[model samples]
Structures are given as structure tokens and as C-alpha cells.
Target: MSVTIETPNAPLADAQAMNEVASSIGLDWVGMEGIALPIEIAGRPVSATVNAGIDLLAIENGQKGIHMSRLYQALDELTQSELTPALIKSTLTQFIISHQGQASCAHLHFSGDILLSRPSLLSEMRGWKAYPFEIDARLDHQWMLTLKIGVPYSSTCPSSAALSVQVAQQQFSLDFDHQPDAISVQQVSDWFDKRGLPATPHSQRSWAWVTVTLGQDAAQFPVTELINRIETALSTPVQTAVKRSDEQAFAIANGQNLMFCEDAARRLYRALNNQCHFDQVAIRVEHQESLHAHNAVALAVWKRGSHAA
Candidate 1:
């Protein structure tokens, strides 16, 4: 006896479509975060941590769930292209299109370090420096793009420098008060060699967290330009490679640009506000105090035509 077996071809079931909650509530944002993706930054490929999502506004259809796979695939397609304002806008538009009527707004956030080769202050050698940066883009009624970066620099406390100068003056008075009318240059030189300023000002490594709202006309990310502008404004960026001359130059820069956190913030605010590409700018400066365990921080914000804080 011959036995006949028949196989049934059936479509796979989609749990997201079949299992819907009874409630008619809508969620603000629904999607994935911490998605690892490789992206091109500053014409170089870099590893980035990405967060992509969309607003769940389709409450009428019971809002089963968003198509997460589509979002992931859309982000994966970006690996071939360099990150730019236009690319980000198009990607977000694709996100909305992929969801059909399920989402009306989309958001994309990614963070990575942009490696830049920096020359020493006085040496001919150059070394790589990684600047941590983030890009946040949102599309709803209008497109909004914000760029943020962290820049490390040296901050010599102004108050501490003043106190050091005062101590040095007192010590000088004590050493030269009873000297002869015609004091020899060798004696003064020996005194300076013996006691180097009597007291030294305290300085610490500081960070400048800068965020800027890009204008709609911006085409490029301007990561390097922004970093350069910030470093110029602060005037004391941390060095990457250094020789003795470079170290001396760095020390001189720190001494010349004595600032508190507030001073640093103000410097960035003024510099960024002058740039026409930035519509809104926010600056946060933190001086990790060498004298104290706590950090000194200053925050400032500036709109295009509004007063800065």
C-alpha cells in the first residue's frame, strides 16, 4: 500500500498586526535605540551609536506597533553615504514613508568621535585627536538639526592666577626691599631662578560642551570647522603630541588665556553667535578644579536675535 502526503503552503502570521491592545492611547515615540551602525563622518568611516524612532500617532488603527525592521534597514542603507544635513533629512523622510500613515514625525540621533590630525603647538609632529560629537535630527512640521561636540582645553583659574601674582609680589618685596640702590641683573635673575614665582596658579583640564541649531541652508556637518572655531575662541585646546617647546607653548597659552567657567562660556557664545550657520547656540563649560574636588560649570544660550544668557 502506497501512502500519499500533502504539504500546506501558508503565509506566516504577523504578531504585530494580529495582537493589538484594546486601548486607543498613542505613544510619543516608539522605535529602537543603541543601534550600532557604521557611518561616514568628515569623509572618514566611523563607528556610531544610533537611535532612530518615530512618533506613534496612528491611534485610530489601534496602534499595534511600528515596523522596526524597516527602520533598521533604512539606517543600514546610510552606511554607503557620508552624513550630511540633506542625507539626514532624506533618511527621516524615508522613515515616515516606510511607516506609511503610522508615523508623522521622525527623529534620528547618532554619536561618534571624529578623528582629526592635530599639529603640536611648536613642533612639526602631528597626532590624532578624537572629538566626541553628536547629531540630532527631527522632522515634523519643520526640520530641525542640532549638532553637539565636546572639546577639551586647559583652564587656568583667574582667581588663582591673581592670588599667585599677589604672592609673587609679596615675595619680591621681601627679597628686594633691602637691596642696594643699583641692583644687579644677575641678582634678580638668581632670585627668579631660586624661587620660580614663589607660588604657581592652579589649572585644570576643562571641557566645552557646545550645541548649535543649524540653519536650514547648511549643507555640510561642519564638524572640523566648528571644532576649529571653538578651539580658537578658547585659545588653549589640549595638545595631542608635544615636545619641550610645544609644552612651553601650551603653558604660555594657558597662562595667557586665564579664565573661569563663565569666561569660557562667554567666549564660545560670542564666537558661535557670529556664525550665520547657527540659528541657536548653547554652551556649557566645565572647569574640573584642581584645587577642589568639585567642578565649576557655566551654561549659556543664544538665539539668533535674542540676548545671550
Candidate 2:
């Protein structure tokens, strides 16, 4: 008589719902992060990693962990449509709606690259350039959107430029000190062809990482316009496609736009200040020194009036 009675197929208890703990004292952000999803940026399908979170107060400590699965599902549904400011706002709103009275703020972060065809500096050829960009959206008492980008350009040190010019002058005097007549074209060309006759300034590939927050006046994300302003301000953006003529032109541009990290930061700080749409701007300029072992770095922040951060 050792027959076993059949048990019920499933558990009769909902552990996650019934097992409740004390409330959290203060949790600034709580949610899933590094969620890999496919999203559309600028009408192109791109892979994006999403980080979403919500603030948990002491009154609502730990019930079921803020329904994290709901936040993930909301973002996953957004991959079907192209990412825009409106979509971000809607997604953040959905988070609050789904959480009801549990969450007061919702935040989302995603990053991807935008591929663009950039025309050559001097040639008619165009080449593809991939620009890494990131967007942050937060919905609480107010809505905020921020964009960040990294621009690479050539940086020639001011001191190096002066020294290079002096070197060339010394070499020229050594070659034609006794000549009474002006140097001929052939003679100047030969002087240039000589090895190490005119010292070239030391220039290194540098980077500018800029983050800007849009004020209420801004309607759409001005990605292309922001990129243009940065590139034009630096004046020595790295070239994509190059020919002999293009290389020569680039050399002249570099000579004209010689800068240090301080100069680069100042240039961007002023440029961003003039834009009404940009309320707060953060600039970081890094020069990977070709001559020195340490890098040159400069940082500047521009905030509107007394609201600066």
C-alpha cells in the first residue's frame, strides 16, 4: 500500500507577488542596463545598447522590483520605428504609465553610429564616414534631451610651428647667405627637395568630445548642423579621401589652423555659447602629443546664466 497520491501540476503560490520586503531608503536609478536591441537611426537600421532606469523612493521600497520587464518590453517595441525625439518622449511616458505611482522619473540611454558621405576638402570625390553619437532622454518633472559626439582633427602645436619656421629660415640663410640676387625658382625648388631643409611642424591626430543639452526652444535634433559647426570651428578636420592636390591643401589648412588644447577648448566654448538651442555645453579637447610623452588636455563648460552646471 505504498501508492503515492498524485500532486498538483503547478505551484499554488505567486512568490514574487507575495514575498515583499522593506521599502528602499533611496534608490536613484533601478532598472535593466546594457540591453542589446536593433534600432533605426536617421532612417538606417543600427544596433543599439539601451540603459533604462527609474528612481525608487523610501515609500516604495521593494515590492516586485519596479516591474523591470515592463521597461524592457517598452524599449523593445520602439525598435520597430525610427528613433526620434517624439519616440523618446513617448517611451519615457510609457514607463511612467506602466509603473503608475511607483516611479516619478524615467530615463533611457542609447548609442549608435551614423554613417554619412563626406565630400573631400578639395576633390569632388566623396567617402563614407562613421560618426559615433549618443542620446540621453529623461522624463520627470520636465523633459530633457542631450546629444554627444566625438570629432577627430589634426592639431599642430603653436610652439612647434614657430620653431619649424625658424628652422627653415636658418637653412635658407645657410644655403644663400652670399647670394646677392633673389633666389631663382629652380634654386628654391631644389632647396625644398633637399633632405630636412625645411622642418615640418609636428602635428598629431587629436579628438574633441562635445556634449550639449538642448533648451526648450529646440524642436528637433540638429545633428548635421552641430557637426558642421564643430568641424568648421576646428578648421583642420581629418580628410577622408585624398589626392596629391588634396594633401597639399590639407597641409596649408593645418599650417593656418595651428592650435593647442586650450585654444581648441576656447574655440568650441565660444561657438556653442552663441547657439540659442544649446543651454549647456561641455567640451573636452585631447591632443595626443607627438613630441611629449604626456597628452595635453583641456576642459570647458558653458551654462546659461546662473543655471550653469
Candidate 3:
């Protein structure tokens, strides 16, 4: 019978003395990443990949490294309940307190696709939509938080609409072989009924990515409101589970609200600028043009102050 000796708990590798040279340099950020964390947002358990880090600027001369496990433990303890602004602030506090005199900064980054239900236009039916979102929270001398979201919409080119109208007028002249002063109203009506449209404008799928610095209660992300503003500004949103009526309404809206990349960016800029809750806002509009092989992109930023970021 052989007995194995248990490893002693004392004199651990973490308890070893630090090298003077190695202990002198301060680390800006050090900690865990890709931590599988489930956060509760708006009563839903949100699966998030969290990146937690902290600055070891206050490390004493004798200390070689800060305890990385402390940050993870802080996250685990606070996240067991739920994720909220207050909980985030508390977790950062725990990270600083765990180090006592070593750490002065803490940051947490989480990103995931949140599932939300959106109602169909001109229909009572609703469908689920997954929106990619990112939330970044930092704590140091002050606290900061920002949220980013992606919104997909339709962009009808103004130039393309004008050109289409011009071509349709020429097509009408050729089809009837008569001028407005000579053709009867009944003849024009019959021609329109037989031929659906002389020419159709070219449009393509588009996207808008927006970021906002939040200054209010962050218990829930304002994804719906942000999406509404973006779609309203552009006047043409990509439909989900589109019915015939919804498709017709969408086509009419697209025709009424023709825009280019620059127009899209400016409209979003103006829409976000009116919101007081967002301290700093930025938007990028991407129009995947069906007319050209290249995409048209525009970015705009607006701040609460005299400048933009």
C-alpha cells in the first residue's frame, strides 16, 4: 500500500517574491477575455461574451503582478444576479476594492445579437428580428457607457429616380406616337393600364450603423426607439414577413422618399442630434448600389457640445 503526499497550500507560486525591475512597469490593462457571461436585459437572459480588464497602475514596488482572478470573480459574483448599470458600477468597485491599493481602472465589453419582435408595416402580424448590439462600460476617475446598433433599411437613389422618370416620359411618347395636346385622356389611361410602368427606378439594400453615448438609465437598451428614428429618417425600412399590402406600402414610401448616401447620412445625423439623452452620436450609412459595382458610404458624427466626435 502506498500513500501519496498532498501538495502544500503555502509558499504558492503566486506568493513568490517579485523582481524589482519587472514590478516597476505599470500595466495599462490586464485581465480576462472571452468570458462566457449571461446578462439579463429587459427581463431576458442575454448571452454575452464579456471582456473584462483593469489597470494595475497603483501596484507597489514589491508587487510583481495584480491578481487577474479578482476581476473574474467580481464579474461572476455581480453577474450571477443580473447585469444593470448599478451592477456594473458595483462590479467595477469590487475590482478596485479587491486590489485595494493596486487597481484604479476597470472596463467591461459585451456584444451579442439581441432578439426583438417587430410589427409588419400595414399588417397586424409580428415577427422576431435579431439585432447585433455592443455595450462598453468603463470605470476610472469617472464612469462611461456607450451602445452601438445596426439598422438595415432601403435606399432609393434620387438621381436614379429622375433618370427613370425621364426615360419613362420618352417611352410614353414613343408608345402613344402622339403629343399631350393630341392624345385623349382615355387613351393615356388605357396605356397606363396595359403597360404597368414605362420605367422603374433602381434601388438597393442599405444599412445604417449608429453609436450613442448614453446618459440615462441603462437598465434596457433603447434599440426599438433608435431603430424607429433611423427608419423614420430614411422613410424606407427593410420589411420582415411582408404581405402584399405591406409590400405595396413599402414601394410607395420608397418612391416618395428618394435619397442618396449623403442624404441618408444627413437625415440620420439630424434625427440623432435632436435626442437629448444621447451625449455623443455617430452614424454611418452604406448603400449597396444596384447600378454600380461599388457601394456608396457616408459617415456623420454629432456631439452635445460645439463639436462632433
Go through the candidates in order and give the C-alpha RMSD of each one to the true structure: 3.1, 3.5, 3.1
lDDT string, candidate 2, 5-117, tens digits:
57778666544344245665656799988989898776667777889988865554355557788888898667877777788888899998987867799999988777777
TM-score of each: 0.94, 0.88, 0.87
After superposing candidate 2 on the true structure, give the runs of residues whose Cα lies further than 4 Å from its correct spot.
1-16, 60-62, 180-182, 195-197, 306-309
List the pairs of residues colliding in candidate 2.
23-61, 24-61
Give the alpha carbon lDDT tens digit for every residue of 1-309 in model 3. Answer: 998758866565764236445655788998888999887765456788999888876444657677778788778864577567788888888888887767789898888777777778898878877667788889999889888888888989899889888987888878877454688889888888987676788999998999998885666567668877887888887877878998999999999889899999988887889788887898988999899999999999888874553
Model 3 residue runs over 4 Å out of place are 1-12, 15-20, 58-62, 77-82, 178-186, 216-220, 307-309
lDDT of each: 0.89, 0.83, 0.81
Displacement of the residue 214 alpha carbon in candidate 3, Å: 1.7
lDDT tens readout by residue for model 1, 190-270: 989999888899999999999999999999988888999999999999999899999999999998999999899999988
Q: How many backbone clashes does candidate 2 have?
A: 2
Error of 2 at 49 (Å): 1.5
Clashes of each: 0, 2, 0
Q: Could you tell which candidate, 2 or 3, scores higher by TM-score?
A: 2
